[model samples]
Target: MIADLFPHAQPGAGLIGGVMIGLAAAIMLLGLGRIAGVSGLAARATGIAGSGAPHGIAIAFILGLPLGACIVASVTDWKPATYSAPLMLVAAGLIVGFGTRLGSGCTSGHGVCGLSRLSWRSVVATGLFMASGFATVAVMRIAGAL
Candidate 1:
């Protein structure tokens, strides 16, 4: 279905994206002494949480996410996957927001930045993250939602 929708799918795009994410995380860590976690950064930007970096920086980082995506989409003939309903999208966002808070960090922080530093907490968190994601997909598949 996806390939039918976007025949120009380039598998190398994932590798490129991963490398770009790693580099961005590295830069944030080394330059600002901060973890490049979207959830934490967004929270700080929205004044929901406190962090070492200034709110302005957090806001910039948050804004950059969509800006970067737009730039990529413009350059590459990449099309985003569409979903069925807006309400379901909002519900999914709320669930992800809750999960990020409950987990104490998002995937970028734990899976990418934390694991890179060899943190035990990050390892466990990443494992749980993957497992939960797999379980969610399995459940969704069984429910004929995927």
Candidate 2:
């Protein structure tokens, strides 16, 4: 039904991805008592930040991201997108990293964990993130940059 409504969309993929993400988040929280925020994990892994989960666990989790994706892609026959602009991609990643630090947490931490726990800060941060994203897309679209 969703496929019929949106011919180019892969509805099942999103449902599956969301379920996997939720399951991973649940496991991280329940088993490790840690918030599944990639930025925080990266920071911890790189010794840029401290507290919460151990550095080793953070490093393992960071490494597991691509490994897990590879496993999923292998099992599902899914292909990830290839970015044409490597430099732009790297710049974007750095900007996002800085934003996450300024915001106190990334989407995974704030949107999933913090919001789930009804944190006001997460609520505001997530709202700003979404709004900023929307605005950026709109500006890019208007400038024919996308």
Candidate 3:
């Protein structure tokens, strides 16, 4: 196991992950003046237009996520797992969209970008998002719907 292989490790993976994400956010903010907010991009992509910066960067970011996954799969002998069903996936998407709108931003926005700026609204939203997620998972596990 990965954990077993690095028993004396100092969370290098998490550190690298945070550094990479910070670099991405910094690059986006400095180079494009964008907030790296996913909800803003999703809104623009769906024709809700508030800021065009998030729209463009969000488009690139969203598209690149799957592309990166594919690249990893191709190079690392990773076999992707299939989802339960197309309808379930669609329902999940709708629910997530609703949650994003209600929460004012997605996790990437509120949790990462917003929290980085020490925004109170973002902190509340992130807390709510996380709590809701935890509740959902716990309920689903209890109901055997997980």
> CA lDDT of each candidate?
0.88, 0.88, 0.78
Q: What is the TM-score of each candidate against the true structure?
A: 0.87, 0.90, 0.77
lDDT of 2 by residue, 1-146 (tens): 87788899977878888888889999999999889998899888999886757988899999999999888889886877877488878988999989998787988999988888899999999899999999988998999878
Q: Could you tell me the lDDT of residue 70 within candidate 1?
A: 90
Candidate 3 global lDDT: 0.78
Model 1 TM-score on a 0 to 1 scale: 0.87
Model 2 lDDT, residue 36, Cα: 95
Tens digit of per-residue lDDT, candidate 1, span 118-143: 99999999999899899988999999
lDDT of candidate model 2 versus the reference: 0.88
Give candidate 2's error at residue 18 in angstroms.
Answer: 0.7
RMSD from true fold, candidate 3 = 3.8
Instruction: Indicate the worst ten consecutive residues by lDDT in candidate 2.
Output: 76-85
Q: What is the lDDT for 141 in model 1?
A: 98
- Residue-by-residue lDDT tens digits, candidate 3, 1-146: 65699887758757986777778778778888777777677677666756565455667876776786688678876676868678978988999888787677887788888899999999999888899889988998999977
Candidate no. 2 TM-score: 0.90
